[model samples]
Target: MQRAISIDQKKIDRYGKINGDNDIIHYDDAYAKERGFRGTLLHGPHMSGFAAEMGARKYGAEWLYRGRLHTKWVGPVCPGDVFDVRIDEDGVLTASVDEQVVLVGSATLR
Candidate 1:
């Protein structure tokens, strides 16, 4: 039931590097193109954070205590790609980017 969250480049870079992902495809446009990507891609965890952020905003900070999340990055999440985060009554959360379902999972709110 939460609105979508749009992550910026700085967040992706900082978080991606923190997670030990130094793939140029994630932070270097030229290198990413060499690897066939239009630009740096968003790390998978970034999407996770986006999902969590949406959950907190919609259901409050207490909603994630006993929650669960499951998602698959079907494709690389490029910079500037805004995603929509949705939560259903059953506790399922879905993150969609450009019509593609990037993150899908469930969590329990304590």
Candidate 2:
């Protein structure tokens, strides 16, 4: 299965509020630039959640109860970046942004 996920400032802010992650880099573009990032960066956990969602969408309820997801953040996801989440027939999962891999992992329903 495959899906497209767009990262935006409103989503980031909401996630931050829910997760109590008030880091300036994830919210302030100027601050993130000063810190050497392209713009407001997405939190790692948020990306992890997207991976899990992809799994659940493909595998249904079993994924929710028995899913195992492993993800490595290889690069940053800035606001407005559209990421592609894809799962191969072998259940290998990958998430990419701008044609570049930003997250690599596997998702399986055990």
Candidate 3:
């Protein structure tokens, strides 16, 4: 299964506030851009939420109760970047931007 998703600065900022991560990489466009990112970056935890949610969708309560997830964000996700969260029959998940895989991992039910 696959779903298209888009994140904006407002969402990123909200997630940062919730997590108390005042990192400039997540809130300051100029600071992030100067550091070579396209813009403020999406939080790793926030991106991971998509993976978890996808797993729950596919596996229901078993995912919530017994699932373990392993993930890595290999590419930067900038505000306004459109991406996809996809899980295959094997339960391997990936988040991609512009066809480039940014996050790769798997969720296993214990």
Candidate 4:
């Protein structure tokens, strides 16, 4: 399966609030730019959630009850970026933007 995941400032801020990731780099543009990022970045775990979603879509409750996910973040996701989220038939999950791979991993169920 394949889908596009769009991230925005509102979602980023909300995730930060819920997950207690109050890092200024994820919320403040100037702070992030000072750190050499294009804009306020997204929480890594929040981006990883797209993989969990793919697992759930494929494995149903088993994905939740007995799923294992391992990810490597190769790029950053910022507001207004659109990610290509997909689960290959091999069960590998990947998230990409503009030909740049942001995440790569696999979701498995027991």
List lDDT for all candidates, in order: 0.73, 0.88, 0.89, 0.88
Instruction: Report the C-alpha lDDT of model 2 over 1-110, residue by residue, as the tens digit.
Output: 88898889999999999999988899999999998888998899998888888888888889878989999989899998997888887678888898889889988877
Clashing pairs in 4: none
**lDDT tens digits, residues 1-110, model 3?**
98888889989988998999998789889999999989999999888988998889889999878998888999989878987899998889999999788999997788
TM-score of each: 0.76, 0.93, 0.96, 0.94
Number of the predicted model whose TM-score against the real structure is largest: 3
Give me the displacement of residue 7 in model 1, in angstroms.
Answer: 3.3
| Model 1 per-residue lDDT tens digits across residues 22-109 | 8777777788888887677888877777777656665676755755566556666677777777877776778777888777776546
What lDDT is obtained when candidate 4 is compared to the true structure?
Answer: 0.88
In terms of lDDT, the best-performing candidate is 3
Candidate 3's TM-score: 0.96
Model 4 RMSD in Å is 1.1
List runs of model 4 lying over 4 Å from the truth.
Answer: none
What RMSD value applies to candidate 1?
Answer: 2.4
- Mind sharing the TM-score for model 4? 0.94
lDDT of 4 by residue, 3-109 (tens): 89788999999998899989889989998988888899989998788888998898888886898888888898899999788998778999998899999999887
Collision pairs in model 3: none
